[model samples]
Target: MKVYNTNQIKNFTLLGNTGSGKTTLAEAMLFEGKVIERRGEVENKNTVSDYSDIERENGSSVYATVLYAEINDKKLNFIDPSGSDDFINGVAAALSVTDIGVLVINAQNGIEVGTEIHSRYLEKAKKGAVIVVNQLDHEKASFDKVIEDATERLGKNVTIIQYPLNEGTSFDSFIDVLLMKKYCYAGGKLEISEVPADQKDRAEELRAELIEKAAENDEGLMEIFFDKGSLTEDEMRRGITVGLIQRGIIPVVCVSAKKNYGVGRMMEFFTRVFPSPNDVPPPVDTVSGNPVKCDAASPASAFIFKSAIEQHLGEVNYFKVMSGEITEGMDVVNNKTGNKDRISQLFAVAGKNRTKVPKLTAGDIGQTVKLKSARTGQTLAAPGNNVVFAKIDFPEPKFRTAIKAVNESDEEKLNEALQRLYMEDPTICVEYSKELKQTIISGQGEYHLNIVKWHLDNIFKIAAEYITPKIPYRETITRIAQADYRHKKQSGGAGQFGEVHMVIEPYAEGMPDPAMYKINGKEFKISVRDKEEYDMPWGGKLVYYNSIVGGSIDARFMPAILKGIMEKMEEGPLTGSYARDIRVTVYDGKMHPVDSNEISFRLAGRNAFREAFKNAGPKIMEPIYNVEVWVPADRMGDVMSDLQTRRAVVQGMSSEKGFEKITARVPLAEMNRYSTALSSITGGRAMYSMKFAEYAQVPGDIQTKLIEVFAAEEKDE
Candidate 1:
């Protein structure tokens, strides 16, 4: 392999819907560049990009695979990511690091949900794109219909660069508008041929439209084109390149990746027309808020876009050099972890295979072995430079489940394996909910979680089960109430004796002003100086008042009493959920100095608060999430009806492109297995995303059932 300069490198990411032939297209491109002697098929599980066990089993790409090929002295790095929504993080990460996106579309199924989703990402990233209409040889393929559908959804910026001369089962040749020639595949090779007489007029019309669109990229070119009625090949190429980089034109190309039809011409366009690495602007430094130029002589800085764990290779981290040159043996610091690490080895990766490289210059993508602290989305810079690049923003997990080891002895192994898996795919979130006392694993959907479960059992020899996660409901008071308790224990040695009188009330931002209250026909005045408010770490507030004016309870015992009250707050008196947003006033209490230690006062405080809580109107608050569902317009009615059954409040509805977007707020408990249910209802055509919104009181009927369930569980334990 030969080293190429930054200007000679072109980085692109292949994205589209599952079964859109992106992997096969990449294979064809690699074969055309002579990087591989033979093309591999997904059905045979021998493709360079989809080589992982999970991918082979699912017959789809799971992880983003990187491969490079040299064509016309230009190094083109192709990042092929999974098209399924379950692995959208891979697509986002690839887009963040690459300059151009090659969106492959199935000629038979044009502008599906996945196509719209990826197109949204492309627009958000403000990157250049080229549409590749693949699978032209399919029986139902319609080149003209696909082009029209694409233009309708993607807008007028889409322009045709090539079209199949004989599409559908007989797709053997395509006419190139830019070159004014026809490319035919015969005898296992591509040969230049003259345009067919029957399609000559159609080809000429498309060529004229292409010239006009390309000329619009520059004023000088437009003037020249208008004066001469056409553009030279060199001038047209320059104009198209500029238009692509500026996102003013989205060139459409046709190909039959499996048959290798028009693949060589596609490679030629990639090498000569696509934007190079230098065409992309530098990224801004996250810490200093300054643009960091891609200069080989500057301090070394790189961003890790993807990380994976291989059986024999351990951890392989793939990163793009943002600035300066990274050489083997150089020491760098992980900005996120602040851990220093030495680069022991560097290699240019082609899927799972790697070739050792002495150095990787700026704008080049390469992989490195075992960095102690480096992970996905981390920025690594030379020590003392202190440069931090912005991290890759990954979408939040859409589904969650509680995971527990099947065997008691495998708990430790399960935890270690989960951590390793998290390092490999940052989208897999493993959280230990301290309140629920369960380990929750969240991902894109049910299938994603299942994959993780498979890894746990097969790779780590630890079997685990997934269950619906328990909702972290909160307990709160609604009314004011007072209660008194006397903890008098006459156990033989050191008898405990203490008495506490507390008033419980609903808490808000500003309330509970000190006032006079009478206890047993006696008037006691509470002062503002004895009140304090505590902001609980979990979520809510607790306002405590120590108003013992006559010295009935010692000042030293107040903390002990507060600690007891907090303990009860953590495990609420009703349903054992965390309690929040309440006010408690220990206006009157009696303590025997010798007998009333922390334990006696603690028991008194706990009993008094419990009694007051029972009198105060307590309600359960469940977490609610704001969910947005994207589905085909025809299925909107069915999806909306299903959401209503789950106690969702439909907030709004809108239409984008050809899909209906419904926004709603639904309780977390009602969303169990929602991903699966939605898939069933929509036939896998709809997708939804959700995030934490707020907490609201559970319905009266649901609250009654929940309390009963909690009581039963507590009795079982």
Candidate 2:
């Protein structure tokens, strides 16, 4: 393979909805570039991109596959990510390295929910993109409907670069407005000629619009277009590149990747006009806060975008050269990990096939293995350079479930496999929740986790089952209460005698200290000598006051009392959930110097606090998430009704792009399987994201049920 410089490289990622022909389009592009002798079909499970056994079984991609093709003197690197939203992490990983996005849209479906989602991601990433209308050979393909939907959802920036002259089942030709020519595909070979007389008027009209739109990118081109009302081919290329880089234009092209029609022209546009790595903004060196430009003369820096474990290969890491040139047999240091690694070999990847390359220049993407330690989002740079690229901002998991091995002995092996899966796909998050006491695995949706389960059940040969995860509810007081307790135990040793009187109250910020607390018509005065406040790790505050007058209880025992109180706080008296935001005052206590040790005081304080919490109107608080859901306008009512059943409090509703955006606050317990429910409600045409908003008190009936359940469990244990 030949080494290409940054300017000679065009890095792009294919984006679309599932069944939008993205993998097929990649196969066609690979064929056109001569990288593959024959194109592979996804249904046949012979495509180079979806070569994984799991992918083959599912007939879909689950991870980002790195592939490359050469366009004359220019090298085109393509990262084909899965089109399903469940595997959106693939898209994010691809976007992190690629300079532009080639969004393949299925003409039969027009703008789909996945299309809208991927487009949103592209825009949020601030990357330029081109729209490819694929599957024109389908009998139901409607190019006009696609164009209309793209204009509406994609904004007015949709520029028609190519339009199918004969769409639908007979699709074989298209008019290129940019070139003012007609292209026809015969026997999978492209033939270009001047626009025919019958189509000349239509071609000229579209070309005029293209020229005017392209001219808007540059002041000089705009002036030329105004003066001569035209733009030369060379001038238009420069204008389109600028417009694309600035995201001021979304050039739309037509193709039938299945039939190999117009695929070559798409490749031509990629090589001729797609923004090179050097054209877009540079990635920042997080360590030095400097933009790492694509400069071969600078220090070497390669940002690892994805990682995987192959059948034979122990571990493979794919990266894009952010700066300088990296060659085989080069030593690099991961500043993030502080681990020195050697690039033992370099390979230009074409799916499962990898060709040895001498070196990869800046902006090129390649893979290397045998590193001692490294992970995705870490940068491998020349020693002393300390270049660390920022990690991709992946969205939090929307679906979560508790996973456990059927055989308890296989838990360790299951955990190890899960860690490997997490490394392969960061979106698949795995953790053993200390509070829930279960291994929680979260991802995009049910399907995403099912794929993970498939890996464990097949590849790892481990049996695991997913259980409903326990909600991390919290407990807090709703009223003030006071209690007193005396721990008197006469064992074989010294007698243990400790008495504690504590007044507990609901904590509020900026509230006056309790000079006196009146409860049940009884007033108790406290002379606070010292006080301390703590920010509890479980999500609230703990205020402790030393109100012992005249050293009634020694100061050394304060810690013991607080520790005991914290034990009760951790295991709330009502429902065993972590308790928060309560102030406890040790107004008065009695202790025997010889008998009252830390244990005695701790017992007394624990019992006294537990009693007070029970009388303080203790309530359960469930985590409420601020969820934002995007659904098709027609299905808004259906989605809304489903949310209502989940006890969601609809906050507001609005319109975003061409979808309805509904925001609500819902209890995490009620949202356990919301992703699956929403997908069913909207016929898989909707998506939503959730984040922790606040912990709110549960309804009285629910709280009562939770207490009863906790008591029953406690009794059983």
1-717 per-residue lDDT for model 2 (tens digits): 889988899999999999899899999988988899999999999999999998898898887899999987889999888888899999999999997888899999999988888998999889988999999998999989998999999888899999988888889999998888889986666799998899988888888888888899989999999999899988888888999889988999999999999988888888999888988888787878988888889999899988889889999999998888899999999878898889999999999989999999999999998877889888889999987888998888989999999999999999999999999999999989887789999999999999999999999999999999999889999999999999998979789988899999999999888899899999999888888999989799999998998777899998899999999999887888899999999998998868999998999999999999999998899999999999999999999998899999999999988899999999999888888998888899999999988899999999989989989999999
| lDDT of model 1 at position 148 | 90
Please give the lDDT score at residue 81 for candidate 2: 88
Q: For each candidate, how many residue pairs have backbone atoms clashing (under 3 Å)?
A: 0, 0
User: Against the unseen true structure, what C-alpha lDDT does each candidate score?
Assistant: 0.87, 0.91
Residue 135 local lDDT, model 2: 97
* Deviation (Å) of 604 in candidate 2: 0.8
What's model 1's overall lDDT? 0.87
Ten residues in sequence with the least summed lDDT for candidate 1: 519-528
| Best model number under TM-score | 2
lDDT of 1 by residue, 1-717 (tens): 666678888899998998999889888888877778899999999988898888888898988899887788888888999888888888889988898889999999987777888888888888888999999999999888888988888878788989987788878888888887888885667788788898789888988888888899989999999999999988888888888888888999999889888877888898888877667677899889998888777898999998888779888889999888888999999988999998999988878778888898888999999899788889988998788877787888888999999887888889999999988788999989999999999999888888898888778878899977999999998887788889998879988988898888878886647587664576657764477789987789989899886789988888878888899999987689999999988988898867888888888988899999988889999999999999998899999999999999999999977789999999999899899999899988888999999888899999899899999999999
What TM-score goes with each of the models? 0.95, 0.99
